[model samples]
Target: MRKVLDPFSLGMWAMILLVITITATLGVWFNTERRNSNPDRRQSFWQTKNPQRRRKSAYVRLALDSFLQKGNFFCGASVEHDPNANLASKILAFGFGFFILITVSAYVANLAAFLTRSEFQSVTTVNEAIRKGYTLCAHPVVENELRSQLPNAKFFFHENGKEFIGMLKDYDDKKCEALVIGWEDTSTDIDFLSMLCERSLVFTDSVLAEISMGFPIRPSLSAGFSYWMYYGQKFEDINIPNLKEKYSPTEALDSQCVIQLSELSLQSADEYAMITVQNMYFPLVFFAVCALIGIILQCIYAFSSNRRSLIGRVSQLDLTTTGTTARKDRFLMRRRSRMKSRDGTQDDGRFRDSRIEATEE
Candidate 1:
């Protein structure tokens, strides 16, 4: 592994970030939801002392819903109050959606690259080859440097680089898993023959050392060798397959597994690909599971909405009943008081008339 990711993949990272964004988005959304529902303005305190809020949330359900669609099902709503919170939520939701889109596109690209990568050999570095415990061949001079640089790695030293070439020819031996040589090593036909026929062999990316060379030759010979002293060509084009033809055109090259793969491809090309239940079993099952989750979330939301509606209706009904009862009680009390005052006035007049009659007698 080049460098291990703390979390497995980009998709997982996106999910983690999206969850946090949705949590905040839902908070604002619920507030705006209640604000829009109420005819009058109200306040809710998040403090510990006054924890009872006018509107509440099903936090776990909101988290699941947020994981699916930026909490659009759970949080996207019209706002009547606190425009700033609503605006922030909208920004977060848009960014959340865009981030998911980018991540999914990247995954598709990676899949395409993976399909094409099978044609090429996996590149390795000097450290990686040593770590893999493959025998590496180099000149004796670089031996001490390599040992000091990578104390744990073992190596093979070949002075003339022929023994290394001989080991490569003995494919069964598998002695020279890698080679470390200079550019001048391939200055002649014999020098280039070491790797000329080795199809899959490659040089690792690690550079052990660098050396400047000056090949001495006569002026007449130097006229033919302008760039490289003798051959004029130091190295061929990066396309290694052409090297086989460039060196030995008459010789038949190995097909490796290309012929076998082609036969296999042709065998399957004519067969009608079937879409049996088995082919779609897992995918359909996954879709059904998702549908079930959506149904459950919707049901939870609906039940919560209906319960709040019922509570509001019941509260209004109680208030109306209480007000009507209070009005009726006040009316009866006033009527009784008026009757008592009128009876007292009539009694006083009667008492006065009786006293006048007594005086006359």
Candidate 2:
């Protein structure tokens, strides 16, 4: 089995599983960060310290954290006076929250649309096609099987490759609804159809009939061939329908279901320019721009606040210096007046003594 099927290994599947695991891990991390970023919902040190004030029921706490806090996963926390985090931290938290919200919402929406399209566009069997009013187109080989299965069904028949291409063109032009060729034939011509119609054509998982072919072999090689054939049949028995499903075109397409950010095309068929950013990235860019603006505004606010504080301190210092100088000036003027009064008293005393001596003589 390894010798036969080693070329087509399950490495891709393993890689896909790894990717899914990583995506799930990142999603969990984002959710946790979003929760922790919320000031109201965030588990505080105080909450741990004051266990008596904590809510009794974990479920009630979760409900309050999710809803009553008036904060959205995208908008971050809306608590009035959260003392734990600062402005920069808050901005970063909100930015990351918004980024995650936008990214996750896009992923979920695209996934939903892809699933809906896959389900809505699929024709699992011929009866489903008929019920859905889809007209079947088939090559001459499968005509008998289709006729027997869908006797009253509307269908278009194509003789060869040329006719098949013509019928596909009609289908592309909306003249015909669906093509009901054999799975092998469809797989061979699918690339051509995609080249012609791009994504307008999609193949369904309906089989009109299964065909088995026989090859001639020499007697000498027949025995070995038969032995291998028996083992191959046994392998088929073990794998069965699961093998068919694993390689089905529908499942292959579903595996590639994702929203691509942008296409690197030289030209665009639309009115927009060729090299334009896809809509999915716009929200992220907008948020980043907003964060930059917030940082700038925060810096401006800090600078203005510091400037005002410095001016106030300078004014207070000037007022103090001016008051001290005025007090010193007043003290000096009072001392000079006192000195003049003392000198005048001394001069008057001398004059009185002289007058008394002259009168006695």
For model 1, residues 141-171, the per-residue Cα lDDT tens digits are: 6777777777777677765555545545543
Taking all chains together, each candidate's TM-score versus the true structure is: 0.37, 0.35
Model 2, stretches more than 4 Å misplaced? 1-77, 82-125, 159-163, 186-197, 216-228, 231-361
What's the residue-level lDDT of 163 in candidate 2? Answer: 56
- C-alpha lDDT values of all predictions: 0.48, 0.50
Query: Which candidate number maximizes lDDT?
Result: 2
TM-score of 2: 0.35
- Clash list (residue pairs), candidate 1: none
lDDT of model number 2? 0.50
Model 2, clash count? 0
